[model samples]
Target: MDRTLTDIPTAPTDRVYIVIPLFNDWEALSLLLEKMTKTVAPALRKRFHFLIVDDCSVTNYASLPTDTGYSLSIMRLWRNVGHQKAIALGLSYLADQPETHTTIVMDSDGEDQPEDIARLLEASAQKPGQIIFAHRTKRRESRLFRTFYLIYKSVFKLLTGKAITFGNFSVIPPNLLRKLAHVSDIWNNYPGGVIRSRLPYQSVPAERGARLAGTSKMNFVSLILHGLSAISVLMEATAVRILLFCVITAAVSTVVITVVILLRVTDQLIISQGAIYIVFSLFIVILQAFLISLLLVFIVLTYRTQSHFIPAKQYGDFVEQIEKVY
Candidate 1:
């Protein structure tokens, strides 16, 4: 099968780095690298250096071919920090490097699509200073997974006051790499952290590709953790939203309790014995809401006071070794 891919204008002397995070997906990654090597322009062939962040993978692509035009470097971590942090580590590593070039952060799984790299680079070439994210136009997840994912997006928007229309597949121009490396949010969720970075960024529509190899690692629990990590990046905003809701609940409860008491005392309405229980319940609700609001305030303040996790200064601690295979 043949597909038309628009080529990006990269200078012949340009050094393009593609950073991919891996976790027990060596076979998928190998296929992805092969696809990229085939699809990229001839002048850019040897210039493309792959930075693979191996998140303590149990399996290995030990039989890696040596005749490929591109160079490959694997940064093996001492322990798995999950895919999101693995990406954070990879980008941080690149940020520390002296070379100033565009780096693309993507997944080892083929779902991110190697073909979309051109679109990312094209967007970068056009918009030099801004980071470009691959806004997925289509998803291939199961109906059940999509339903839950939709729910997650809705809640994320409602809580954070920001809509997330993209994910990890993004292009980070050289200028913004060091700045993003210092942002703490990347430790929790790369895309969410990028959003929180408050840096200039734009999105390009790219369809999600099917998995090239093994079964997906995502599950109900992983989905929840992923969502929570994203939300955690904007914890201050989420906490404030929750606090406002609690305050509103307390005020409404108080007003209803007052109305019930007035009716009970004034003989304006025939209040039964249940009226007392209703008043008591409303009072309890008010107390609970007030307490919750207070706790949220304390938490938000505490979070603000604490130090943030800067990835650049700490990424090396997780990396066990770096292997250059061809």
Candidate 2:
């Protein structure tokens, strides 16, 4: 996953737009945009468009120095809805545009690496229809950050029964873009939603790069919420698993209660004093577990019945304005 930058690959003749979600990271974005302008060949750069999703940043978009050589645009949201939603809205916006053939989603911070994008593009070419994911083989983060990230991945797999190793960085084909626009879960978690979408996708091993500018905005609390959001998209599966656990706990408690009862009736010493407490505890456990299982069943049913927002349908509501810079 430790990658050495090679000569920039020739971009496809077809038009491609790169979508990056920005939240007060204009400095990094400005540098990245400029670097991309110089790194990519002129003809190739012409075919590429930069779509910046300003997630209601406090800084004025106009203040950020623009590189006019590359085609760039900014989509400002009505409110800050976090990075995942910003990416979702951006993808939704592009799905409607006529010129959108391939959409690449990446973070404005250099952690996603502008150079790796060419690798993503190359992977997309090998398999024309399949979505290409920039899978992380190694991370350039602190030990604590990496540890927490690994734990998050494990918990995600345990709850959702799917292993997600990728993030926002990926290549979306024209046909798949349409399908993804309708998937509501993408609004919460991009990679998780894509996994649930059941679309064919392939992952190309890529190394994580250092941030280009300021410190990361993702704190511990934010990381927890982000992880929960990903898990939330797979709520149905999680609910079922919880229900199953409850059922198993109830069953075990029931057996224990029956054993305690038999012991109380047959053995005088067993029921003398503490036997009542044991029986009562087992019964309480069974009742609580059973009730929880029942509640989860109802919750899952309600969730299924609810009408969730379809990105294709509701994306426009969040968009404040779209400005084409160059």
Candidate 3:
């Protein structure tokens, strides 16, 4: 399905701190917050606060609303980090806040659906101390996109030994913040990190909502990068898996070459010139596969030794400015 975030009807919660990242989508953000006002319970109107991470958008920030009951804060980054990194920074910013509160990570462009927040809140109430995610039961993307998405998911599971069932639309309980904020993998992909961490998590089914105000900047290339980013979070495991596959390929090829030579020598079969060439060519494949496996092993070992940037500690370095707009 083709979606232009022009206008759409699309959530509830405690003093939930809603964290959203934006890039030239001020109008959609404004409309999303407006809908959020009507979604939460009446008694919890002021309880919902918002933290918007501006990814150095060239668009003016003054296009946002000024008067709202919700407490809104904008954290502007020095450079354009993607939404995944922006979310990691936002979580790090709130790492030391009240432990009784919960943080909601969602999209501002309306595909996440504000109305479904109520369902998430209710689920969170029932399962305290666990992360809750909005699982898409139905998607509205084009058929081609869905096909690629399915392939991505399959590859992710095969490489990482874990299934990715959710995205950034998640409710993270504050009790886990101090620890999770420091997790390095979230800088690449939030949901992937959560899965990799082996944290307690649950999902509430939601249908994908239409975009709110403008066309999405997401294209095929960006989508592919998104998949790669998610997979990258488990680089060590992926490397190991690939290494094993390469080893298996080389072993099988060696066995085939041995059998083909033995059959010809024993006069059990007459090998054609093309067949002989093909059998001998396995040596090149075997050598290449062995070299690739060795490289992967070196990568996995090196990755284990290198120090990485931790979000909770380094996020402040990327923050340029922060303002409370409402």
Q: Which prediction has the highest TM-score against the true structure?
A: 1
Report the lDDT tens digits of candidate 1 across residue range 1-326.
Answer: 00111122233447777888999898888777777667766566666777888999888885754444456778889998999999999888888865557888888888898778887898999999999999989999999998999999999999999999898999898899999999989999998998888998999999999998899999888999999999999998999899889889888988888898899889775756878899889889888988888888898889989998889998888988777776
**TM-scores of all predicted structures:** 0.93, 0.90, 0.92
Ten contiguous residues with the weakest lDDT in model 3: 1-10
Q: Encode model 3's per-residue lDDT on 210-241: one tens digit a residue.
A: 88889988778888899899988899889988
Q: State model 3's lDDT.
A: 0.81
**Model number with the top lDDT:** 1
Put down candidate 2 lDDT per residue, 207-313, tens digits, no spaces. Answer: 98888888998877888999999999898898888888888988888888787778777784444578778878888988898888888889889989999989888
For each candidate in the order shown, give its overall lDDT on alpha carbons. Answer: 0.84, 0.83, 0.81
| Ranking of all candidate structures by their TM-score, best first | 1, 3, 2
Positional deviation of residue 54's Cα in model 2 after best superposition, in angstroms: 0.7
Runs of candidate 3 exceeding 4 Å displacement: 1-14, 62-69, 98-100
Positional deviation of residue 146's Cα in model 3 after best superposition, in angstroms: 1.7
The alpha-carbon deviation from the true structure for residue 159 of candidate 1, after best TM-score superposition, in angstroms, is 0.5
